[model samples]
Target: MCNSVVLGVDIGTSSTKAVALTLDGQILGIATRTHQVDRSHPGRVSMDGEIWWQEFVGLCTELSPHAPGGFAAIGASGMGPTLMLCDAAGRGVAPAALYGVDTRAVEQIRQLEDAFGAEEIYRTGDSYLSTQSVGPKFAWFRQHDPEAYAAARTFHMPASLLVHRLTGAYVLDHQAAGQCSPLYDAARHRWIAERCELVAPGITFPRLAWAGDRAGEVTRTAAAQVPGLRAGAPVTVGTIDAWAEAHSVGATEVGDLMLMYGTTMCLVATQDHRVRHPSMWGSPGLVPGRWTLAGGMGTSGAITAWVRDLLGGSSYDSLTCDAAASGPGARGLLMLPYFDGERTPILDPSARGTICGLTVRHTRGDLFRATLESVGYAVRHHLETFHEAGIVPRRAIAVGGGVRSALSAQLVSDITGLPQQLTRISIGASYGDAHLAAGLLADTPPLSDWNPVVRVIEPRPEPAYDELYRLYRQLYESTRDIQHALAARHSASAGEPLPDHRATATAPERSVTAPERSAPVSPAGPDTPRSPR
Candidate 1:
């Protein structure tokens, strides 16, 4: 096929997207299907895996006519630490459990802390988990839903499970798998049979693959469900979507870091070697032999969205502009973006959000401004660990849904006093997946030759920023005790025991005894058994 294109499929919490792109960085077609996350309770969130797969297949075909002769390469990207169960037939045995924000696993969290000493855990990887961790979710499953647990044969992330359905292969990427902390060992690059036994005993695990490894081709039958894709398109097992975005933004070189300002503010740095932060994840990113020093703010743009939703308007532009006008430090008001809960630094799953030093004189604009600075403050928190470990990034690549406004980017640069570069492919992971797919296929082309930076934000250090950042550091350290106290009180009212630090590493999950529960359910209704693809 002349001008061969690569297809990228990005499966996310709220939607599934696919795109058609040329090796020369030309976008030929794109499609997205929105899906709602079921949040029936304060601590529960899930999606039906069956629905995700169907939507993905449906969208691919819908976008196919936009690119002629089909795509020559295909790569997938997805959210990480996403846990779900499948029956032997490969159908989702139940709704998929999401990561980063799900809080039902608080009980499991307590159990983990009891088993793995906090000091030990911090030393190993500083990866303090939230209800968003995959391990505890499994533990919760085994304790509360014994039957479902007994029937579940394998525990897999959403993306790997999707690949299994499409290619009939049982495979996962290192980045995706690595996020399955306490299940997959980042240092060893293998499933820690012992830890998995302690946290999720007997749950079957998928075969592992490195980022960018070939995961087999799309089946002709599966291809029929999605349009514009050739059955034999080379499919590469992909990396976590965040990692994919970092790659797409050209944050692959050493010393260049990416700060993703989306639902959350995530930081990922490209380093020649693995650098672990007691509060961050140090895993292999997109390139081999390179470490991505990664961490995230539990909340970022979400708070901004919250303010708008609260104000009941499309006044986001006004709010941001107003915040910009109100000046630095928001008149001494500070916000803690733990509305849903926290992850990095303060890994407290039970922590509640806070807004300290609110005054009658402070307008909503000032609060909004403080909220923006809070997000940047968190960036500083995660970055402090990087700095302590000697992982010096020259600057950070700012990407994601949050960088649309010039003022927002400028605010971040000002807060951190670091240059923030913005790239052209703002669609992020989906675009990154296309780049990966194209680079992998012999018929496709290279990334450096294609995707290039569109603009860069130079550091504009402000006089007030130094003090603002200092106050930001003090906020978390000073208020953690109160946050936990709030969590305990809330837990007592709900009749649930408060989670303790001991719960970060050890909780029990079960195995699937029933054939249907052995693995993820495939398409065609997940009722049949799985053989090789």
Candidate 2:
């Protein structure tokens, strides 16, 4: 029984991962299943919710052999406040609308802000309405797809979706529920019933629980589908992947910030009291009586992937090498990392990517280096915002697939002038899920013993970054109007007009990718396998 393992699975934006680990945090086995999201239309990113379940089963089946005595418990997390509206039978009616990356709810955000009054909404929700909020997406669905909306009975984010599939328990963590801005009252820690009727009428909201609380036992149906998972094993109510990743690295202490470099870059600052700002999001922490101030950039590694794909398909290692050779200022090139528009602080879906000071003298390496620096500047911007909100992080711990790049982490530290602590087991949110699941056991060790800081990335004094940071801030303001106009032109060219009373269109076609494969296991260090959410 002491050797029995806990299973942790996470459904993310680009992939789903599962890990089997013991109570003291020795990772025995890990698996990853990579997939892509649908971007057939502009400002829209989605995936079939059923794909999440399929990947969950595949990952669990692959990792089952590592746990010989059968799994003791299960925990899950995912990229969220996503919206996956379901029918009476718990099947997704349409592709799940992803988080802030899907900006189709811009107009709906404005409408909700006006209807509820920005200040009142902030007072209740503890965060301003933006592309990240779940309410506007609900309103968008209500207005565009009336038939699907009428048929929808319940909704789930990635974590809750997995919980429901495994345990037959429809529940969401309070941290996730709070991000459903304007639909959740943060002070009261309950769903705003009137707001629910206003945005998603007749849709039943899931019951709320803490991230570590036991939701239910795995059902016989799920046990048969997932190899080695016992029918009566308990499962924890997991929260969003970012928060789970935070917990993985012991970032829940007051004044500790978890900096996640993944599909998108996110910063979560844990606090004892709530911190509210129009630009940042505030949510309940993983446990009761704790709070978090969170914000993210809409693009990070996504930009890196775009650059890599565009400049011939070279591996990440070769690209990093070329980027490092290009040196500190990127040969006078600068970039705005807003290819998918911006989030947090700016919150402008109309924003567009910009590369300034480009000339024939510049090479692909310079462009890639500029892209990395752009993310650093964005991180500095968010840190400044956190400082203004009176929540200064005493320590910043870096985790995720992006942390696999030493150049990326070092550049961020140099630009922000803050040291970043890298943890021992950076297998990401799945590892954190295991930690949550282990809490159900009486003899579970502390998180510090489970995972500890292995290295610290100290900041170097870079004179070029100070000047570049000034220009980076100015570039956005100077080009705001032009970017908005071009964004409108791009939308018009895409020609997927929003549905109205005159005509309603069917959902976009689902994309099929190669079969999921397991990432080879590596030693515990900077190179550990992590699929960025």
Best by lDDT: 2
| Cα lDDT of model 2 by residue, 358-426, tens digit | 999999889999999999999999998888778778999999999999999999999999999998988
Model 2: colliding residue pairs? none
Locate the minimum summed-lDDT window of 10 residues in model 2. Answer: 501-510
Q: What local distance difference test score does each model get?
A: 0.70, 0.84
Tens-digit lDDT string for candidate 1 (1-533): 44787878878766788888877678888888887778665566777777767877787778777667777878887766688887655676667788767777876766775687544443343254445467778887878787777777675566676677678877777667667665555555566666666776556667677667788887897777667767877788886778887877777888988887777777887776556655556665565556666776656777788888877764888888888888878888887787767766555565667888987888878988888878777776776767866777886788787898677778777777777777667877888888878767554444445666778887676788787778766776688678778877776777766656324322111111111111211111111122221
Off by over 4 Å in 1: 113-132, 443-446, 491-497, 501-533
On TM-score, the candidate that comes out on top is 2
* Model 1 residue 68 lDDT score: 71
